[model samples]
Target: MSDASLNPTATDRWMLPEGIEEVLPPGAWQLESLRRRLLDVYQRWGYQLIVPPLAEFLDSLLTGVGHDLDLKTFKLTDQLSGKMMGIRADMTPQAARIDARQPGNGIRRYCYIGSTLLTRPKGVNGSRAPVQVGCELFGSDALAADAEVVCLMLHSLEACGVPATHLELGHMGVYRALLARTGISEAETVALFEALKRRSIPDVDHLSASLPENERELIRALPRLSGGLDVIGKARALLDHADLTAALDALEQVAQCVQKDFPDVDIHIDLGELRGYTYHTGLTFSAYRSGMGSALAHGGRYDGVGASFGRPRPATGFSLDLRALLPLIQAQATPPLAVLAPAEGGEALEAAIRELRRTRPVIRRMPGDALEDYSDSCDAMLTCKDGVWRPEPFSNRS
Candidate 1:
């Protein structure tokens, strides 16, 4: 229907759209291997794997807690039903739908690894499509659920070969409780939230200027509350309200539990840092390494996401982009010893090829395909010597 489709040129054939990429050679291999390993790790932790449809009704995709995801989603009209549909920008809401549909009231843990499409790139030179790998826990309000997910996230990073990572923890309850006490209107609260997210102290001062000086000082103090665990003490000293005090107590409890469980991970607290303020109800956290500008993986306790699906359950989870993680992973290039067998080989060579494949990979040499075709893929070649087929290094082949 289009001119480019009818008569494609060399430029069309070779080029790809910006923010999209193809994982070639070793990168593809590493992605697949990492995906499998992470999924396996999640399964061992009692999380069942589920695959939700890639595209669904727009309303269904946007149902609960997706204001951020909504802007990133790609939308289209379904021809058969003539209804709006959306490609998922994140899979957490879908996982929530699945959990809500489950038969009983017992706890449910779900894990998923799949590709998600976004309208915009997540970071500098990021892909529009990222392989999302994550797990969600539902039906538990205990701090242990938050602790479990955080520990699992740490194990996940360790499994992916990330080195010497740190954890930054925050509780949206702190800010939400403080805001509720301020008695500010919704519009002003949202404006203040955006400013705080940007860590713009001047804008916070400008926006909260109308509030009473006491309320304004508390709002202004939020962005300054980032550091090691002692920051919690400062937060408690600054806020005296009973509900706000309770929220700080919850933060202290969760942070202590996580520290006890994982003593090696360095923990930082940001009482004012409300990353998922609208959705996340309680303890929120993200993992970081040395060079990444953004978090490696992030999630938090979103207690009411299931309410939109007719079931209100406590939920928390985290997701990481597998494609983005490939660069962060300190992977050792242990390329498999692939044996290339000639097409003309008889049943003996075929049998040998099958047997070798069981131990290592085997690349079949197709008819009319040159040796160079298999050069980079295989390090060794199968040869016949005195009626016995054997594999020798490609460099040593005569």
Candidate 2:
């Protein structure tokens, strides 16, 4: 059916577009709790929280980042000013802009928790609007600084009650060097890179066939370059080019540092895993659990990204989608809050309700004609019987 025919008034209340949602039933307590816990972690680590404006000039938003991110940003012209504005699809660039505007003498740590809107293609299920919670550390490129961010991320996951999470480490330097060694045209290099991302070995093999003998060997070996810590040693041996060797050394150093401090943390090296924003310069890593198909958290070194924003500070940080974590983490069902029924013309009863709220989350009204029916919806029902407050038990399908 035509959209106009389905909603003749176009203003029909029931007709709404996809990719938008209403938060009803008021169960944001869990989400808020998660955010608070994460922010607490950031705070203890000396990262001050900041909330960047949701809208900015499209040019400002896309200034530093590469074409890939620029294409995905949602753009629109402001009606009042007739200036192009874009909704922030990512927060890191905004944070960089903020740092540039307010140049500091020393290092700065910033954290943010907010919602971002993105348009998902038709086949994808679930909400397109995602909640992004992340932290960025600026003005430090010390390898130890990068390690600290990874450690904090691991601890944050642990604080959130995530279990058996492992950190998969990789260096963008290694991946790019390997690609450059292939001696392929710029177009072919991009295609080969995409194939590696998709883990399509056959396609990579086909593409590598036209390259020099040494380059072909490097391309064909891409698939076997991932596993646990052993991949680091393999990468060191497999890569012969100078740039590739240097990248391998950096990855190895990070592996050693992580092992020294976090012995129990499962550290896997995937020389082929290259996924991050354009700002990522050196070591990049992500956290994953067995059940989730995607990384629960990912971040890496982006020393050059800050410079693009006019602040020549080295920075690195990671952000996790709290919504993505909900399905993976074990959810503890919170007991229903008690609903108190107001007494008829009783001032004392209202005072008592206010006192009760100090210790517990409370809902105020009982729904429906039958009081017994509504009782099950709350943890307990409070009502004044003969000028005395009484508590009654409530339950629902457990």
Candidate 3:
């Protein structure tokens, strides 16, 4: 791609940047309906809603989030102070900053849905501007909190009518423990993490070459440790470290709770699903529709996200692309048909229009406007007959 190639011709001037999109008509309406529906579900779960700023100081935005987000964020300079600023690529950190201001260690539940502008797509042809919806719980380290969040995630997908959803659970702490036992430098740990994420045997072997035999063997098995419930048992038997047990217990407990509640949801365990490996502190899970290659929703515990705000409290959450959900949202109710009003209207017609609008939409025809102007929206017209105004089926005459 060159500068010349970047130049837009007149025919392509309306072309949006790659990976960016705009929802139109009924799709936008459906998207809003899903947003409202899920937010209501979150409210019922006692997760209060909050709207974080779309952009903020760069340091404030990226300080405690991991390198993955650091790469996705779009940066700019604020004119007021010459300070660097960034458009939010993820709302989790901003929510954490808000939580850090709380007075006590009491559990605070918050939910948010907003536009997130990423510098690049998250996956192939993924949206760069996603209407991200998520819920965050702070101040609790118990596995119960993890389970509760997972439950809410299921409720979210169900509310949107997403079907055949399966969940894959992982524990970053397990991977972290193995990495720690290796006693490798920060750089080495990061390199090994990348290799494990890819599950490349050659890379894993090469990276763990100098590590202890036991430590190397444990981590080398982590990527391949994804499957049914038996994966938990397998990891327990294969891993010799006691530290690994706690993380494993956390994963199992959360998995059990999810299974018991969401009986139909197919569950899989993936120790290598190091979603935000350097960022997430503990149990992580992602939900996928049967055939979709990418996760529709995913979240994990990222306890240190608030440390930069001076309050290091436990936190966990998940986010999904609301705009991406428009197609899959099958149950949105049809909005009521709008009623049309004649441009020439007396006090009676005006009052009738107002009264009708109270229950449903009413589109008043402007002077010089024909009935066809609202043909796509309005079905009936308010008519003055005798002394009363009543609605009659509207027919376009010209």
TM-score of each: 0.92, 0.87, 0.89
What TM-score does model 2 achieve against the real structure? 0.87
**Stretches > 4 Å off in candidate 2:** 1-12, 121-123, 181-183, 240-246, 256-264, 277-279, 328-330, 339-348, 366-369, 383-392, 395-398
Candidate 1 residues lying further than 4 Å off, grouped into runs, are 1-8, 330-334, 396-398
* TM-score quality measure for candidate 3: 0.89
Candidate lDDT values, in order:
0.86, 0.74, 0.86
Model 1 TM-score on a 0 to 1 scale: 0.92
**True-structure lDDT of candidate 2:** 0.74
Q: Candidate 2 at residue 171, lDDT?
A: 82
CA error at residue 186 for candidate 1, angstroms: 2.0
Candidate 3 lDDT score at position 346: 81
Error of 1 at 113 (Å): 1.1
Model 1 lDDT at residue 129: 90
Please provide, for model 3 over 339-383, each residue's C-alpha lDDT reduced to its tens digit, 9 standing for 90 to 100: 888787788888888898888778778888766777777778888
lDDT of 2 by residue, 312-376 (tens): 77888888777666644425445355664543436776776777788765556534455555554
